[model samples]
Target: MAPLSWYIALSASLFVIGLYGVLSRRNVLIVLMCLELMLSAVNINLVAFSFFLSHLGGQIFAIFVITVTAAEVAVALAIVIAYVRHKGSLKIDEISIMNG
Candidate 1:
């Protein structure tokens, strides 16, 4: 079996990449995708630890997180679509126009 450290390192790497993408990207859709990537990293950590500990708590919490993520994606995408229709582009720099 692969070691727990390997899973942790992989998760951490993905999380850092996602964090960087979210911070550095100027595209709204890309930022949202990076946010999802970060969430996926969290799920990986949760599942890995759950397996190591032989406990259901982490697994259950991961499920709740997944549910919340799905809802968030639905709502966020709706907002993004509306915003794109108004702005005519997906650049995050232009998002400030909505900061009323």
Candidate 2:
């Protein structure tokens, strides 16, 4: 069995990579994908801790996180589609809808 520390390290690495992607990328789709990667890292940590502690709470909470992530992705994609239809581009830096 892999050590808990290894799992934590892996999760942390994934999260950092995702954070960098989200921060540095200009494409909205890429940002959304990076957000998913970050959420996946959280899932990995949850599962790892659940296993290490022999408790189901962490696993259950992870399931809720997955559920929320799915809903978030669905809504975000819908928004993305609308944005593309209106603006014809996916660049996050080009968005000015909130400017008033």
Best by lDDT: 2
> Residue by residue across 35-95, what tens digits does model 1's lDDT show?
9999999999999999999999989999999999999999999999998888788888878
Off by over 4 Å in 1: 98-100
Q: In angstroms, how far off is 26's CA in candidate 2?
A: 1.0
User: What would you estimate as the lDDT of candidate 2?
Assistant: 0.97
Q: Estimate each model's TM-score.
A: 0.93, 0.97
After best superposition, candidate 2 residue 71: deviation in angstroms?
0.4
Candidate 2 regions exceeding 4 Å error are none
lDDT of 1: 0.94
Candidates' lDDT values, in order? 0.94, 0.97
RMSD (Cα, Å) for all candidates, in order, is 1.1, 0.7
